[model samples]
Target: MAFTLGSLVLLCGISGLLTGVWSATIVPVKGNNCPKGWTQLDCYCYIYEDERRTFADAENVCNILGGNLVSIHSDLENALVLELSEAGGVAPGGGIWIGLTDAVSEDDFMWTDGSNVDFTNFSGGEAGDDDGDCVAMVTDTGEWVDDICAIPLPYVCIRETFRH
Candidate 1:
């Protein structure tokens, strides 16, 4: 009985040591607090809520948080934007501005990141020309439209972590 008791204690100590080592080495450490009104997606954080600001101001805010204005390039991204707009409880009359415009010229809509607009998800034909250079999202219609980027419109910002 004495020998058994000693062995049990030894085994317990070993198990505790192993658990500590595993926890210390296997678990990844999370650093810093996430940006305000943002949620983590994978290793990056995102804010899907609509914010009222000019295009330049929106870009500045996103850059301060190490990100850029939301740029939709795929159907999945477009669907996500729709979901966020609905969830934000924005009034039916309000529209969300996206990070797309042909302000550089006409009929040459591009993202603020300087990427070519490969996907044109506009509802009313191609954007630009005839008072349509900026892009805004209409939740009621689920389409993008060209508008004036200088206008103070609600916009979406995207923040991605820099992996080094």
Candidate 2:
């Protein structure tokens, strides 16, 4: 009976020590690791607010926050944008500017990350480049369309991680 009690005490002490270490190292620092009005998704942080700004201006804002305008490249990314849209209470009015454009040329859409465009979630027959070489996310239609990148519009920003 004494041996069992000693074993239980030893286990409890080890668990308490581990819990202390975890709380000190693993617990996130409020507003430091993640900024105010932002949420952590994977290794990135995202702000779902709707802000009216040009694509370049949006990029600047994101840069100031150690991030960039949102760029969608896969089904998972698409779903994440849809989720953010819903969370931000954005309605179907105007399209939100994303970090995609073919401003260099037609059919040459590229991401700001210097990566080639691999995924496209544009609406049917949209992104026809009738006007500009930029892409925007339509809230109502939930699709991408080529537009003037310089035009000011609501946009979502993506914050990258900086591990120290």
How accurate locally, in lDDT, is each candidate? 0.71, 0.74
Candidate 1 lDDT, 10-125, residue by residue in tens: 67668779776422223448764457676555555557646678878888887786777777777867777766777888666567878787778777667886666777678766
Of candidate 2, the 10-residue stretch with the lowest lDDT total is 21-30
lDDT of 2 by residue, 1-164 (tens): 99997787677668779776422223436444567777666677778657788888887887787777787777777777767776777776567777887778788778865656778888885467468777888877678888887888877778765465
* Candidate 2 global TM-score: 0.72
Best by TM-score: 2
Best of the candidates, lDDT: 2
Model 1: residues with Cα > 4 Å off, grouped in runs: 1-36, 39-44, 162-164
lDDT of 2 at 142: 70
Q: How displaced is residue 159 in candidate 2, in Å? A: 2.1
